[model samples]
Target: MKALITGVAGFIGYHLAQRLLVEGVEVYGIDNLNDYYQVTLKKDRLAQLQDKPGFTFQFLDLCDRQGITELFQSHRFEYVVNLAAQAGVRYSIENPHAYVDSNIVGFVNLLEACRHSSIQHLVYASSSSVYGVNPKIPFAVGDNVDHPISLYAASKKANELMAYTYSHLFHLPTTGLRFFTVYGPWGRPDMAYFKFTQAIEAGTPIDVYNFGDMKRDFTYIDDIIEGIVRLLPLAPQLEDVNSLEQSTPQAPYKLYNIGNNNPVALVRFIEVIEAELGKKAQKNFLPMQPGDVPITYADVDDLMRDVGFQPTTSIEEGVARFVQWYRSYYG
Candidate 1:
């Protein structure tokens, strides 16, 4: 079967597409090559998959209506995975328009294409940030995510709503995965882990937000991908609209929290990274900034119940693997 994966040049997209391709699945990938961080890194990722059999790529933007429709009409994709978006909470505060353009308008275009193409299933990326300012300890899929602190989070929430609409109106099989603090090799430099490694290696001070009091469910990339791979075949079956708490009530729609299910303190996470790198980091603790959350924990019972998903990688091992790849990639 053929799969069309958006944001194939992105960290998660690259890894997911690689996994599917290795499994002998035909994959068509696309990205606009936007200079969000460094286009070179994105290009480097795309280069790795260009020569693989059953792998093809296009330089296209989701906001381009005609482009998206034309591509969908031409390719017979059995599955559609939407991973492209304007990511980062802090950056969202600066360029809010980018989020609306890519995450909102661009997403609508993708949904339109899927609806017209009669795609079998659509799996899209959501963010834990959607549970903004919730006092809840571990964010659950059934929780109320009406308050989003950042535009990026709001756009993601909007995507979930839009997906449900398509599913209800067209019976489209749609699944949304709320990923939390995903990190590993070939990760984005804009992420905290990548930035921390860069600063620590250069003897620079690493910024610790919320005075190192924050907590996060730092999930490894492999674990997140495993959850997605398992859920790929578990399509929803549409039923009646009784309550909003039910995720997959036979309505051909579902949502799951793909996370470590263990929140690690920021200071502790940094300690693990330092231990792995065999170096001490110069820390610059700072108060929480706007559009930032104090903690993010995930209750992934639904994921486990449906797919037997469990995160087994510890921070120490995950950090060590990342450090090894960072040294070789940048040294």
Candidate 2:
């Protein structure tokens, strides 16, 4: 099978590409290589896949309508995975327009391309941030997500709506995966786990937001990739749509939360990092930041039932793996 993966240089994207390549799948990957985090790290991720067989890379932006259309016309992709987006909640608050251009306008261009290309299935990355102020203990796919606190969350929710519209109007098969806190080796430097590791290694104080009261469903990268691989062949069928409680009978669209059902406390997460690094962290507890949620607990019952798998990586093991990669890469 052939697949098109946007944001191929990203942490999750790179890992997904690697797994597909191992399974003898031809993968066409694209990335703008934006300096949102560190361009060097993205380049390094791409470097790993550059020499792999059945893998190709292109420097392209999702916002480029003409370029994207040309790409779709040139390659007949069976599956399209849209993981490229202007990520980060706090960054979205500072620059709302970035989210609009990438998450909204860019997404529209992708939908148009997919619709015209008649792609078999389109899987896109949705975030747990979309839950936004949801008081529910474990956020479910059927839960109401009308209130979004951050522009980032709003853009993701908008993507889900847009995908549903495409599925209903154009009969495009779409599936949205709401990812909880994903953490692992070669992960984003902007993530808390990475930052905390860097600070503790340097003997500096790590910033503990929400005064260490926050909790997150930190899912490992391997688990997330496994879930995606299993769902690729199980696209939403129009005939079986009614069986899905979260989907409409008329639309071939579905949404599922892929997360470790267990939520880890912020302090406990830091302790794992410290233990892995063999160093003590000087934590600077601070008030909750704007656009930050106190906790993110995902209810993955539907995902488990459909995929027969859910993220099961524990925080301790995941943190240790990340710390090993960080030390080896940075040393």
Candidate 3:
């Protein structure tokens, strides 16, 4: 079976592609290699997969309609995983058009391609940010996410709506996974965990936002990939639509939260990083930033009930693993 993965040079995309390659699956991966973070890091990721057997890398953008259409026509991909997007809450505030072009327009292009290609299952990444400002302790798929504080979250919500429309009108099977704060080796440099690691290693100060009162359901990359791999073969059947009471129509569409159910405190997360790195962080406490939530807790009951798995990597272990890779990669 051949699978097409967008954003193959990204954190999650790289990990997912690696897993699929090990499973003896033919994989076609694409990435624009934008300078959203560092071009070198993305290129390094591609280098790892470039020579692998049954793996092909294409430097392409999701917004390229004609190019994407040609790709779909040429490769009869059984599965399509859309992981490409302008990924950062704060970055979205400054560049809203980037989110529109990548997350909105690019997504519509994917849906249209899937509609005509007869792809079996289309899995895409959503975000925990979509639960914006909800008073709910553990965010669930059935909860109301109409109020999004950031344009990034709004674009993800738009993706879900667009996928549902395609599923309803064209009978395509689409699944959206709402990922919590994902971190590990080869993670985005812009993320707090990576930044904290860098600052502490450099004997500099790390920014502790919200006065270190924030909580996040930080999920490990391996655990996230495990959940996605399990759901790949299991598409949502139209008859199963009635089982879920959310905004799900009588279509082959589903949404699940793939996250570590435990929410770790911001201070505690930093503590883990420090312990792993064998150094103390000089923290500069600051008030909450705009579009930043106080906490993110994912309710993975639906994911567990269906996929029989949830992210279980502890912050302590995950952070230690990241530290080992960070030192080796940067050394």
Best by TM-score: 3
lDDT of 3 by residue, 1-331 (tens): 9999999999999999999999999999999999999999999988999989999999899999999999998989999999999999999999999999999999999999999997899999999999998898899888889999999999999999898888888889999999999999999999999999999999999999989999999999999999999999998887555235666469998899998999999999999998988899999999999899999999999888997998999998899899999999999
Error of model 2, residue 188, in angstroms: 0.2
Candidates ranked, most accurate by lDDT first: 3, 2, 1
Model 1 per-residue lDDT at 94? 97
Ordered list by TM-score, greatest first: 3, 2, 1
Best candidate, lDDT: 3
lDDT (tens digit, per residue) of candidate 1 on 28-67: 9999989999999899999999999999999999999999
Clashing pairs in 2: none
Report the error of model 3 at residue 239, Å.
2.7
lDDT of 2 by residue, 40-134 (tens): 99999999999999999999999999999999999999999999999999999999999999999999999999999968899999999999979
The weakest ten consecutive residues by lDDT in model 2 span: 240-249
| Model 1: lowest-lDDT 10 consecutive positions | 240-249
Assess each prediction's global lDDT (C-alpha) against the native: 0.91, 0.92, 0.93
Taking all chains together, each candidate's TM-score versus the true structure is 0.97, 0.97, 0.98
Off by over 4 Å in 1: 240-250
